[model samples]
Target: MSIDRLFPNLTEDNQAELERFGDILKRVWPLKAKHREKLKYDIRDMSRGLTTERSERKIDYLSEARFLSPYLTYFLPWNLYRMSRLFTGLELDIPDGSEVADLGSGPLTTVMALWMSRPHLRERRINFTCMDRAPKSLQAGLKLFNAVAGENSPWRVRTVKANFTDHIKRKADLVIAANAFNELDWSGRVARPQAEKLAQHMAGATTETGRILLIETGVRLTGRIIAEMRTQLMQTGFKPIAPCPHVEECPMPATGQGAPWCHFNFSVKDAPTWLQTLSAEARLEKEGVSMNFLYLSRKGGKDWGAVRIISEPFKFHGGRAQYACSHKGLTLVDHGEKQRPLFPGQSLVPNWPANPKTDLKSGALILPNTKEKR
Candidate 1:
C-alpha cells in the first residue's frame, strides 16, 4: 500500500511539523560557522561509533544539537518508513481501543509511527503511554505528538519519566521498543540474564493476544541480542509472529557455531529533501537503512509451512540462491532460470516435491518443482 493510503494526512502533517521544528532550532540555537564546524566533527565521530559516551552524558552541548537536528530531519522519516513497513508486512490485527505503550520513547517517534500506520484508531479511543528517562526528550515528544495528533485528538496520551529497565505498572495491548534493546549493554557477561529479564518483562506487560515489536539497528551484536531474546521469549510462552516463520531456536545467533547473524535491509527511494540536506552536511553516505526487528505475540500454534527469505539473493549464471529459515532449519534454496528475484523480509510458500534431493555439502535444499510466490 502507498504511504498516503496507510497514513492519511501524515506526509502533510509531518512536513508542517518538521518546518516548525526547524524554526525552533534556528531560533534557539542559530547555526553559525563555528557550530557548523563542530557539527561536522560530531557527525564524523558519530559515524565512527564514538558518540556513545557523549550521548550518555546528557549535557546540552552544540554537538548534541548537531545530533538532534539530523534526528528530527533525517532519522525520523526513516524510522517512520521502517515502522510502516513492519506494520504492513506483519499484517497485525490490532483491536480498536487498544492501549499502546512505548519504551524508551525518545521524542515519541515510535508512537507517531504507530498512529500514522493505524489512522483508523484515531477515532477509537486508543490510549498511549510513553516512557523514557530523559524528561526533556519526553517533553519534546509530547510536543510532536500534539502537532501530529492535534490537541483534541481522540487518543489519550500520557508521558512517564522512568527508565525502561524499571518495572512498569500497567499492561498494554501493544508494546514497542525501537533502538532501546541495543543500549542495555547486552554484550557483557550479563547478556543472557539481561535478555531473559527483558523477555519476562515484555511478556508480563502484554495481554494474551497483544503483540510486542522490538526494532534495533542492523548490527551483528544487536542481531545476536535479538536472537537470544527471541529464544527466551518463546520459552516464556510467546510466539514469533513476523520475520521468523517458525518457533524453533534461531539458527543465526553468533553463539550457534559461528552462524551468520539475522538481520534485514529495506530500500528507501527518493528520501525527503531535509534528509538529503542533512546527509550532505554530515558527509554521510546516503544509503538505505538496515534494521533488525522481531514481532512476538502471546497467541501460538502458527504451524504454517512457510519460509522467509533472510538474506539478499546471490545471482549466478542463470539462477539465484536464497537463504531461508523455517521450522526444519536454515537452508539455501536454488532457483533455476527465469525465476523471480527474492528479497529479504519477503515471505514465500514453496510447493515442495514428494521426494526432494538435499545437498549436504552446501546445505542446499534444492526445490526443483517448487512453485513459489511472495
Candidate 2:
C-alpha cells in the first residue's frame, strides 16, 4: 500500500469541493472590511502565543472577542481543512445513531470536518457533544454549525461549557480530541503524569468497540507527549490502529536530547487560494502542515504487514531514502529502480530479504525494497 493509497489525492473535483466549503465559511461568518484589516494583527498575536509562548498555564483566549474572531475566521478554517484530510484517510466504522464526543472542540471544528469529509454518515442520526471551557467559542461554534448544517440535518449538536479534563457523562462510539492535548504543557520528558490521566479519561469515555483519535501539532515536545500517551493507552488495553504497523516499542525515539520525533507532513496545495491569501496577509503563510496523531481502539486494528513511512525523503549516498517503521523497528529504505517515491504517512508492503544490511549512522536496518507494490 503506497502512502498515496492512505490519503485522498487532490483531484480536480476534490479541489472544487474544498473551494465551495471555503465559500460557505465566508458566507456564514462574514466580516466587515475594516474588521478584516484588524483581524490580521489579531492572527499574528495569537500565532505567536500558540507557537512561541505556549506556557503550561491555560488562558481563556477563546472568550475574548479579539482572539475569537481571528480564530474563527483564520485558524478555524485551516484546522477544519487539516481535519478533513485526516478524516478522509481514516476508515470509520460508526453505526447508525452513534454518539460522538469532541473534547476541547473550539467552534466544533472536528465535528464540521467529520460531517464534510464523511458524507456517508450524513443520513445517520449522530449525536455530537462538543465540550470546551469557553462559552463564547462554544456558542459561536453552535451557531456556525447550525448555519452550515442548514435545515433538516440528521446530526444533533449540543454544547457543554466545561474543560476537556472533565469526566464524560456517556460512552461514545467515537471520541476525538484534535489539537486539544497540546494545550497541556509537557517538560519534553518521556514520562508525564498528564498523559496517564488524559489516557484514563479518554479510555473511560470510549465504548468497548469504539475508537479514539488524538491529534497535536507536529513539534518535538508534542511528539514526546504523544509517545508517552501511546505507552499509557496500551497499558490501559488499547491498540493503535494507524501510523503504527506493529504495537512493538515505537522506534521513532521521541525523547532524549535532540532526538528525532515521529510526525507526518501533508501538502496544502489543495487549499483554497483565498485562504492562502488570508494566511499570507496575516504573516503566517502555510505551505504545508504537520501533525502528530494516534488512532487507537480497544479491539485490534487493520491487519498489519506493511512499513509506515515516518520521515520525508532525504538524499542518501546519491540515492533517495526514507525512514520507515515496521515490525522490525526503524528502517532505512533505499529506493530501488522504477520505484515511486514514498511520502510521509504512506505505507509500503515489501518483501524483505534475509539478513538486510544495517546503516552505521542511524543504526537502522537498511531495506533495499525495490519494485514493491501493495
lDDT of 2 by residue, 169-242 (tens): 88998998888877765764525678888889888999998888888768887788778888888888999888
Candidate 1 residue 263 Cα shift, in angstroms, is: 1.6
Q: Report the C-alpha lDDT of model 1 over 1-374, residue by residue, as the tens digit.
A: 00111111234544444445444444533567776557655655655552345345433221244466445544555666666555545566657678888888777778776665655556778788888776666776677667666678877878887777676677888888897776567656799898888888888898877888888767787888889888888878888877777888786775644567778776655344555566677787566667788888877536686766777777644778777676767756666676665667766676666765675654546554256443
* Total backbone collisions, model 1: 0
Off by over 4 Å in 1: 1-41, 50-67, 256-258, 316-318, 353-364, 372-374
Which pairs of residues collide in model 1? none
The residue-level lDDT of candidate 1 at 338 comes to: 65
How accurate locally, in lDDT, is each candidate?
0.67, 0.80
Q: What is the TM-score of each candidate against the true structure?
A: 0.83, 0.93
Candidate that would win on lDDT: 2
Judged by lDDT against the true structure, how good is candidate 2? 0.80
How far residue 142's Cα lies from its native spot in candidate 1, in Å, is 1.6
